[model samples]
Target: MTNILHITASIRGDESVSTGLGTALVEKLAAQSDAQVAKRDLDAETLPFVTAERFAANSAAAADRTPEQADLAAIADTLIAELQAAETLVISTPVYNFGPPASLKAWADLVARVGTTFKYTDTGPVGLLEGKKAYITAASGGTPVGSDMDFMSSWLRFFLGFLGIADVEVIAADGIMGADGEAKIKAAHQEVAKIAA
Candidate 1:
């Protein structure tokens, strides 16, 4: 069975346009592919921010880690395990201050561990998590999807690519506060249906 991981950063819950559309896409994929779904809601269950101690703990050898370090490493292990197990990933987030949410950033920091998700080589840093596909839902009130003012979508693509997830599709629900909001959402759903099929 295929495993799919859905990560959400919007705190608006049911009211979030990004997450709502992402859910529709995931449901469609599950229905068509018989995929098992795993959800990680950053709003409902916040991940701990990476600290100096946690960073050191992740880099140290398993046998040499202290109790506190072990505990810290365990948290990262759980997150990484989820990512590694999934063949596909769905990330939904609303643009906040021209960037991603803090919770998403924190999760990224934890998952980008050296010698774990990535490794340093003479050729440069190489990502370890290969053969994964990602779908990103980016919602904004006014910022256009590929406009110069929008940085979230580009950054997400680059970040996920760095971790070896290069096959990414971005669904943008932009100008959500404008008069044509409904049409925009409908168009996004149409795009989702096309991709999910």
Candidate 2:
């Protein structure tokens, strides 16, 4: 069976536009394929920021590591394994302060480890993970598409592509703070439909 990893980074729970779009996309994807979905809710009970000790532990060799270091390494290993095992990944994020949420960035730091998700090669930095498709649903209260203020989507695309996920699709729910917010939302949904189709 195809394994799908669905990650939601919105703290607004049911009121999140990104979450709603992500859910709809997953539902559509499920109906189109025999996929099993696993969810990680970063906003709800988010993982702690990686500590200095944790970082030190993660870089240590297994056979030369202390118990604390070993435990932290194990957590990192599990997260990498989850990402590797998934055939597809869906990330729902709301732009915060002109960027991705802190929790999501933390999650990225934990999983994008060298020798696991990516590696440095003679050519350049190469992503170890391959054959996986990714969908990014980004919601923003400012900085509509085609505007100078837009930053989140391009940054996310670069990050994901840097990790070797070339087949990345994005749905931007922009202009969400003004009086035409409802119309913008409808347009976003229409964009999602186009992508889904």
Query: Which one wins on lDDT?
Result: 1
lDDT of 2 by residue, 1-197 (tens): 78888889999999999998898888878767878988889888567678898888777767888987888878677777878889999999888877778988888878877776788999999987778899988788886643556666677677778788888988878778988888887877887777667
lDDT digits (tens) for residues 23-107 of candidate 1: 9989999998899999999888788988899999988877999998999999788888999999999999998878888989888
The TM-scores, one per candidate, come to: 0.96, 0.91
Model 1 earns a TM-score of 0.96
TM-score winner among the candidates?
1
Tell me how far the alpha carbon of residue 59 in candidate 1 is from the true structure, in angstroms, after superposition. Answer: 2.0
Worst 10 residues of 2 by lDDT: 144-153
lDDT of 2: 0.82
Model 2 TM-score (2 dp): 0.91
